[model samples]
Target: MSLRLTLHRPPPGRISLAGIVPNRLAALAMADIERLPLAWGKETPALGEFFRVAGAPGPHLVFEGMDARFCDVARGMAAGECEIHGAAGDFVAADLLGGRVVVRGSVGAFAASGMRGGELHVQGDAGERLGAALPWQAAGMRGGRVIVDGSVGARCGDKMRRGEILVAGDAGDFCAARMVAGTLAVAGRVGAHAGYGMRRGTLLLLLPGAAPALVPTFVETAFAADVFLRLLRRHWLATLDAGGAFARRAGAAEWRARRWLGDLASDGRGEVIHIV
Candidate 1:
């Protein structure tokens, strides 16, 4: 059975649970798990002080009763599975290397900053910087897939080097700004300044009225996306119910698209596309 951590009471302050992923805790005894130190504001407290733990340590972990005060829910996880049954705070999957993380509720900002590899599925809305770079780093999520079933806040894939980020709902401003490489598909409306400084990547807009203010540096193009659409259908869209349906309709052989290439301000290789 998997270990479970249920909140005993509302935490006094935001708690940083960054290093408590299943891969690290699965081999520890219950006593050791409880004794692990967690940061609560400026003070440190044993994990058991805020949570009631049960079940044997294992590769699967479940967290229940999480709220906005619980931050860094799965930071630096290398492997295993983690499921959060309720809302979570900032940096939900920062620097993740491998594994699957599922959040049943909304998340705070910087949800997947600097992620290297993994699968993060958020069933609810996500805050700003969904897959953005860290303050000290130049690139964001290097590899991975982030699927958000609900809307997302600003700068969703800023400075990304590689990966795929799918937002089934609306995305805020600058959705793929300064991206070096990656694929970002948004199924709903996109806010202003989307792809403002993107250098190299594919930003797919699947719905009407989702156009961002095109950067003047970009040159409109007529490139066909036949191969790109097929790849998405075969690898990504086929896995989700709504996404699959949307992909089928949008990926039809007859479907035409409008493309724009740029950040001529930079390498001028990135593309922004809208399904027509």
Candidate 2:
């Protein structure tokens, strides 16, 4: 039987679902978490009051028709797949080290920030400063995959050390600000300040547009014998219904990872791709 948590409505105020599900990286004390303190208007309450909890602690978990009022549905998840059926608030999959987080719709701000590993695919659009470092933090998401089916606000993928982010739509300003390493693929047009202070990494453009300003050293190369592109397409396959259909038609296999090097301002080793 598939262990699923049907989230209908969330309790008032901020409720943390961090470590709510056990991951391969660590073990959870269900008894302790169940009895752990939760804030409810200055009062502590058990997690049982809000939504019904079903399923034992394991590597796999699923949420059915999760509400918009809910935030941190799968915060700090380490491994396995967590599917959110609808829209979500902030930090949808913050600090997720591994596994796949498939959101059927859009997401809030700071989505996938500080992520270490795994994939976060948003079927729709996204908010501001996506995949970027949080306040006072040195770097944003270290590694992982963040795919946005639509546009994003400013400062996306800021200070990202490694991983891959593909946006099939448009973007806001300061995109990929100060990227340390990784690949950010924009399918459509993008805002200003692309790769502003990027020290290293690749920024790919699938659409027809001019390169961002404030870039110094640069080189555009043709698609060479790069195997990583094939690897990326295969990684995005859907496992089940609804999403599975989308995956089959995602056109992910259309583009091969061609290599290009640029952002000479930082002697950046990053490569930007162009889809033919």
Candidate 3:
């Protein structure tokens, strides 16, 4: 029996739903859950005051009718599955350690910041810093997988340490800036400054036309890398849906790309591969 929480009225202001993940709800009774405190602006209100709780307690938790006013939807979730039927605010799955979170609509900034492990699927667009580190954090997204079906804002994977972020649509400027280690792939067009100060990581761009302009710091390479391309194709096949745009384009028989390595300012180790 899965538990469901449906918003019954508009919130007074921005609401923080931190620590309301399935792992915590699984141990609480219906009455106990309703009494849980939710951070609303300067006031703390009972969960029941805003949502109409229903269904049985279980590992599968469903949130219905969420909007931008709701933040930290599934922050620090360590286990189980969570589904958001509507749009979610910032930090949708921040610091997720294990489990899966599916958002049917768009999400605000820092969707998966500080994530250690888990899977976050956004059926719609995502805001800035999709899988990047927080302002005060040293490393972002130590491990996990994030799939954004639509476009993403700037600095998508800034300061990312370890993880995979796949975007089916366009990406904003400064994508993967200062990345330490990770794989970030974009199937559509990429904006300026794709990789600014990246130290070590792989940024794969699968655009159809001519490659977008890259910073002068990146130098082109002549390495064929057939074996690596084949392996990457296999990985994409396993990670993305077969019918998705990214998978369809990545399935090309001739997987050719132009590789550029640089961020000479940051050791010149990171690579930017542009599919031809």
Best by TM-score: 3
The lDDT per prediction is 0.86, 0.70, 0.90
Error of 2 at 169 (Å): 2.0
Q: What's the best-to-worst order under lDDT?
A: 3, 1, 2
> Residue by residue across 63-182, what tens digits does model 1's lDDT show?
999888899999999999999989999999999999999999999999989998998999899999998997788999889988888899999999988998888888999889898899
Kindly list the per-residue Cα lDDT of model 2 for residues 1-276, writing each as its tens digit.
234556656657666555554462135444543464554456777755655556655666666666555666567888777877777777888898888888888888888898899888888888887889987898888888888877888898988878877787887887887888887877777787677777787776666444444455656566543576666555654432334333433354476444456566775666666554
Better of 1 and 3 by lDDT: 3
Q: Kindly indicate the candidate among 1 and 2 with the higher lDDT.
A: 1
Candidate 1 has what TM-score?
A: 0.93
Candidate 2 pairs with clashing backbones: 133-140, 201-270
Clashing pairs in 3: none
- If the candidates were sorted by their TM-score against the true structure, best first, what order would they fall in? 3, 1, 2
Compose the digit string of candidate 3's lDDT tens values, residues 79-188: 99999999999999999998999999999999999998999999999999999888898888889999888899999999999989989899999998998998999988
Number of colliding residue pairs in model 1: 0
Q: Which residue pairs overlap in candidate 1's backbone?
A: none
